[model samples]
Target: MKIIRSKSFTGERAWAALDIANMNGITTRLHWTDQPYKWHTNDGEEVFVVLDGQVQMRYRDLGVEREVLLEVGDIFYASVGTEHVAHPVGAARILVVESEGSV
Candidate 1:
């Protein structure tokens, strides 16, 4: 079995991710970032979990922009067709589960 230590995880670049699982047409990943991700809609749905640090999560609903602060242990769910982006407060580690090959 492989084990990961989230606290010591770092990437060569922002938003770098490591695949944890790829099964049943779904993918689970561990991501490290210190930058904002571009807004985009998922192919299916997405479940985001903050493992370390904080994030400013922005989304659009009814053409209106909104944002929320996601702290450690917080979770964010994005339904299909939901436009959203994430900006880290600094360096952060996030666990993301989504449809395989989705962006």
Candidate 2:
């Protein structure tokens, strides 16, 4: 169990991969500035948790977009092969939990 602070990734508006497990999966967080960022996976599942501010997730497959105004305890999930991008409305933090194998 590892803990990461939000202030650690202050310079970049990108995904900070925290923990990785080949047998299990990976856990990461996207700390955004006032810019947009994209995250995609080939074959895995991911769980997104909003830590602060607002973020909008744009999906490429369905050609749909979702604006998630996340507080401290908000969470979302994304499936495999889903091309998704996120833009911060303001300064925001998002936690991503990814796992491999059968769910």
Candidate 3:
């Protein structure tokens, strides 16, 4: 087990890649920021845990759009091949756990 502190980050967005599991894989920590960005992959699913602040997750598919709000202690999952983006409503922190595979 390991502990990642928030102060280790150089910018507004801090990150730490942790190998907590051997079979399923590990996790990544994403510090909150105002930037809106999209993430997609053909590899595997991604699990997100909201540690602090608020975030809006948007999913788009075949002209259809869906949005969800995530607060602290909330968890969300996104399957592979799903085009999505997440933006911080204020300042937020999220823990992302993904299966080890090609992206």
TM-score of each: 0.97, 0.63, 0.69
Tens digit of lDDT per residue, candidate 2, span 32-53? 4567775555467778777776
Question: Which numbered prediction scores highest in TM-score against the true structure?
Answer: 1
Model 3 scores a C-alpha lDDT of: 0.65
TM-score of 3: 0.69
Pairs that collide in candidate 1 are none
Name the better of 1 and 2 by TM-score: 1
Candidate that beats the other on lDDT, 1 or 3, i.e. the better one: 1
Candidate 1, overall lDDT? Answer: 0.96
By descending lDDT, how would the candidates be arranged?
1, 3, 2
Over 4 Å off in model 3, which ranges?
5-25, 61-63, 100-103
Error of 1 at 54 (Å): 0.3
Winner on lDDT (2 vs 3): 3
